[model samples]
Every structure is written in C-alpha cells, then in structure tokens.
Target: MDATLFSLYFSALVAVYLLPGPDMALVVATGASRGVRMALVTSLGIALSRGMHVFMSGLGLAALMAAHPVLLDVVRWGGAAYLLFLAWQVLRADMRVDTTQGAEGSAASGFTRGLLTNLLNPKALMFCGLFLPQFVAPERGPVLLQFVWLGAILVAVGFAFDAIYAVLAARLSRRVRSASPFRKWLLPTVFVLLAGRLVAS
Candidate 1:
C-alpha cells in the first residue's frame, strides 16, 4: 500500500472506530469490572473475528452476494432481526451484577464472546467488502496480498482504540458499582440502535 493512501484510509477508519458501539462498551465494561488483562483478551477475540471476515471477503463471498439483490435483502433483514434479538436479550437481563453485595456470577469467557459476536454480524461482513476497495490499489501489489495487509491494518487500529475505550470506561464506572438497573436500561438501547441501523440501511 502507498504511504499516502494508507494514511488516508487509516484516518477514516480511526474516526469510525472511535464512535460508540457494543464492542467498545463490552470492552470497557469488562475491563472496568474485571481488569485490563481481561479487556485485552476480549480485544483479541474481536480481532480474530476480523481475521475471519477478511478470509470470507477474500473468498468472494461478500462480492458474490452483491450480485444477487434478493440474497442481499435477505441478509440485511436477517441481520436486523439478530440485532433486535440481541437488544431483547439485553433488556431482559439484570444489568447490575453486584460483586460487593453477593457472590458474583461466574466469569464469562469474554474473548470468545467478543469473537463470536463480531463474526455473526452480517453487516460487518458487508462493510468489510465495501470499505476495503476504497483504500486498495490493485496496481500496488497482488490483490490478495494487498487485501490481507489492509485487513491487518484495520484490525490493529480498531484494537488500539478499543483498548482506549476500555481504560476510559474502567475509570468512569468506578464511582458506582450498583447501577445495574441503569445499565440494564442503557445497554439494550445500543442493541436497539444497531438494529435500527440495519433496518434503515
């Protein structure tokens, strides 16, 4: 990749990554409640999912779906439903797990959860197919090689920002530990927004 093109793409991607999202929230929440080590592990999970998406994109799965309009619509709608399901799950669960009040629930394997969550998002797969072409120059090198490099670049950038978010959330959530009621109300809102985005697009 050309240095100038890589810088431009990197800047745009960083801007997008900085925006609020579930992945970021989870990282922050997990880190605050657990620790940085757990948060870093979760970031690795998200990166693994990104790697899988890159593999899928290279196989032409993303592009081939674009050729079939009906299939694309089905994917879009199905993704919307999944997002809503996630939203519902968030709403139904008790947000606050009081570590101070009682024995905490068993520690979740956050890394695996993060990886599975990202891999399952069809919109993310579509975005990968769409976003990469803007920065890639076929003449720069072999197409697959370029694709792999760009995917790695994006994942690295995203991982760094997610860690930052984790630290910030950890710092902020410390004053209040018994706000599960509020968190319960707040977290579902994100999933609902994600679902709306899917439906609107």
Candidate 2:
C-alpha cells in the first residue's frame, strides 16, 4: 500500500475509535464498577469479536447480508435486545463491592457481554466490509492480505484505546465509595442508552 494511503487510513481509523460508542462506554463502566482486571477481560472479548467481524467480512458475509435486508434487521434487533438484557443484568447485580467472591465468574460474564455486544451488531460487520475496502489498492498486493493487515491494525488500535479507558476509569473509581449511587446506576444507564441507539439505528 502507498504510504500516503496508509497514513490516511490510520488517521481515519483513529478518528472512528475516538468517537463515543457502546463499546467504549461498556469498558469504562466496567472499569469504574468492577476493576481494571474485569475491564481488560471485557476488552479482550471485544477484540475477539472485532477479529471475527473482520474474518466474516473477508468471507463476504457483509455482502450477503446487504443483499438480504431482513438478515440485517434480524441482527440489528437481536443486538438491541441483548443490550437491553445486559442493562437489566446490571440493574439487578449486587453492587456492594465484595472482593472476596465471584471474581472469576463475573470476569467470565463480562467477557461474554463484551463479545456478544459487538458480535450481534450487524453494523460492525458492515463497517469492516465498507471501511476496509476503501483503503485497499489492488495493484499493491493481494486484496485479502491488505484486509488482514488493516483488520489487525484496527483491532490493535481499538484495544489500546479501551485499555486506556479502563485504567483511567479504575483510577477514578477508587475515589468513590462502593455504595455510591453513581456506581450502581451508571452502567445500567449506559447499557439502556446503547440499546436505544441500536434500536433507533
């Protein structure tokens, strides 16, 4: 790929990652409420989802969904429903800051939440299909190879940002009381809003 084109792609990717979205909100919320460890685990799950999305895009799954709008709607609605379910789970969770138990279990749940959140969103897969192809130069190399390289970069950059958010939120969380209403309600609110956004989209 041309250096100028690669630079432009990187810039655009960074800009997109900087935007406030459900994935970022989830990581920050998890860090604030749970701790850095769980948040990092959640980020890992999201990274895996993004990798799968890229793989699916390379296999032309996005094009298949585009050809059948109902399939897209099914995925969109499913994602929204899952987000709402997560909101409910957050609302019902015990937020008493118990460090003695359920750490392992909660971390596993967090990973699943992060994975499903992105994986079910059809827009994410479509984004990989659309955003990646724009930067591909047919004459430079194999198109699939270019996509793989770009996808890896995208996942790496996204995970880096999420890790930053997790650390910052965990630091800030230390100052607040575990019993605070903010910790109790912030995550549920974020999840609800994300669900609404998906439904509206």
Candidate 3:
C-alpha cells in the first residue's frame, strides 16, 4: 500500500469513527450505567465485530447484502430486535442489585450486546464494502492482505475512540451518582432511541 494512500485513508477513517454512532452510544451508555470495566468489555466486543465486518467484506458478503435489500432488512430487523432486548434488560434490571453492582452486568452479556449492535447494522456492513475499496489497490500486491490491514486500522481507531467515550461517560456518571433517576433510566432510553432509529431506517 502506498504510504500516501494509507495516510489519506487513515485520516478519513478517523473522521468517520469520531462521528457519534451506535457503537459510540453503546460504549458511553454502557459505561455510564455499568462502569468502566463493562464498557471496556463492550468495546472489545465491538472491535471484534469490526473484524467480522472485514471478514465478511473480504468474502464479498457485504456486497452481496448490499445487492439484496431483503437480506439487509433481515439483518437490520434482527439488530433492532436485539436492541429492544437490551432495553428490556436495562429496564428490568434489579434496582437494588444494579445500585450495588454499579452496572457490572455479565461480561458475556456486554460482549454479546457489543457484537450484535455492530453485526446487525447493515449500514456498517455496507460501509465496509464501500469504504475499504476506495483505498485498495488491485495491483498493490495481494488484495486480501491489503483488506486485512485496512480493516485492522479501522478497528484499532474505533476501539480507541470508543474507549475514550466509555471512560468519559463513566466518569460523568460517577460525578452524578446522586442523580438516581438518571442512573436508572439513561441506558434504557438510549437503547430505545437507538432501536427506534434502526427501525425507522
């Protein structure tokens, strides 16, 4: 890969990743409700999902999904349903346990939430198909290697930004711990809003 092309792609990737999106919202919301550890774990799941997207894109699955609107809708609906489940989890959490636990839900559940949130978003998959190709060079050695490298870059950038958001939201939550209702209601609200957005789209 040309150094200049990689640099340009990195710049664009940073801008794209910095924008507020589902992944960022998930990290921040999880952090605020659950604590930094859970939020970080969630980021791990999200990073891994980025790897899945890269793998899917390399296999031409993303393009295939883009070509077929029904397939994309299936994924989208599944994602929206998953988000609703998450909201239900938040709303139905044991208030006393949640207060004592400080959002330390199961790490596995957090991971699953992170994974599904990304995997379900057809836009992310489609974006992978559209975005990566712009920086790839067919004649610049093995195409698959370039795809993996670019995908890794995207994941790394996303993880870093999401982690920062998680930490910041967690810190803010700590300061506002006195705001009991906010602590109780925030995650469910965010999840519902996200689910609505997914459904609307």
Q: What does candidate 1's lDDT look like per residue over 16-129, in tens digits?
A: 897876577667766665556566777888888888888788787888877876777776777667657766865665554446544323234456656765766666777788
Weakest ten-residue segment in model 1 by summed lDDT: 101-110
The best candidate by lDDT is 2
- Candidate 2, residue 142: CA error in Å? 2.0
List per-prediction Cα lDDT, in the order shown: 0.71, 0.88, 0.85
The lDDT, on a scale of 0 to 1, for candidate 3 is: 0.85
- After superposition, the stretches of candidate 3 with alpha carbons farther than 4 Å from their true spots are 95-105
Q: How displaced is residue 105 in candidate 1, in Å?
A: 10
* Residue-by-residue lDDT tens digits, candidate 3, 1-201: 767887899899889988888888889888887788888998999999999998899899988987888998998899899888888977887423344444445777788889888888888888899899888888988899999999999999999998999999989988985875677677778888888998898
Model 1 misplacement above 4 A = 25-41, 87-109, 176-181
Q: How many angstroms is residue 158 displaced in model 3 relative to the true structure, after the best TM-score fit? A: 0.6
Show the colliding residue pairs in model 1. 96-180
Off by over 4 Å in 2: 96-102, 176-179
- As for candidate 2, its clashing pairs are none
